[model samples]
Target: MKAFVVYCHPSEDSFTRHVRDSFIKGVVDSGNEYELSDLYKMNFQTDMTEKEYLRDSNYRTTPGLAEDVLAEQRKINSSDAIVFIYPVFWTDVPAKLKGWFDRVWTYGFAYGEKSMKLLQKGLVLCTTGHTKSELKKYKLLESMEKVMLGDRLFKKVHDAEFIVFDGMTKACDLREKNWNKNLETAYQKGKNLFAPRS
Candidate 1:
């Protein structure tokens, strides 16, 4: 199986980058092929042009998608599984990724008479400054999952999961404490990407 990884972090010197690399290594070792869209590195255009917005709002699917958007859509159709790796910013994905959705999830592709293929799995591996317990205390974790899994990946993938590598902010002691453990989990997740969930 092939996995399409949408990685969106701006810095190379980050725990999130380590998580991404470890996961890719595991996927390779498991004998699976993968494609990567490093949004920052590739300078992915995330903004939705006025014309683009109008087209979606009007439910127009006349085959005039931007090349970048079309490229991302092609990646989704080709891959058997999709993986999203990034850091949580303001209780959500970074702006670039949000824009990626806005621009790429056009009418008749990701929604509304969709042409996108149903994938085997959808997985999110996100790092956060807050602890999972803290996010749960305020129901933020639940909200995040609902948005990502329930809305975005819903009906697009047969199986879906959301994973947070939490408490990794520079000011948090747990950042250092959980570093290796979190990376190992990410690697294992990739290694078992195609395995049946029990």
Candidate 2:
């Protein structure tokens, strides 16, 4: 299976990176082909310019990123599944990571105003947060789900799964344990999501 892992974290020595690496290890150990897109390492531009937005193009256009976006779109098109790993700040994704979305996931490629078939097949969201899981837990917190899965990623894509790992502020054995557990869980989920269909 081919998996595209999109990781978003500023600090290279951060706990988020640890989680990302562990997850990648699972994919490697499973003998699956994968691609890693590190937003920070790429120094991706996150904001869209007014003039670029004004253009009537269906796909996202940056000052100097037309070719790059096209390249990413081709990668996404070839992948069997996509994994987005990042640390949630203020209950949202990093600006650069979001920018990756704005720039790459274009209309004709990711979705269409008419046809609704998403170019990508499987979509998985593996995310972390600074706060504890209990604090952010809410019964009606489906907004993120809808936007990332239901609306954006899943709108064009068919099969999808949402997996989240919360609580990272308090660092200790407990945090490590939970994080590892979540990593294993996500790994297995990714394997299943990208498994070749019979």
Best-matching candidate per lDDT: 1
Candidate 2 C-alpha lDDT tens digits along 1-198: 677788888888776787677767777777887898888888767776565455426353323547767667667767767777877665567778788877675554554542223434555454544434443466323555566777657555556666666655556455666866776776665555556445
Instruction: Please write out the lDDT profile of model 1 over residues 9-70, one tens digit for every residue.
Output: 99999999999999999899999999999999999998899999999999999878899999
Per-candidate TM-scores read 0.99, 0.79
Q: List the residue pairs that clash in candidate 2.
A: 118-156
Candidate 1, residue 45: Cα displacement in angstroms equals 1.0
Q: Alpha carbon lDDT of residue 120, candidate 2?
A: 47
Candidate 1, residue 66: Cα displacement in angstroms equals 0.5
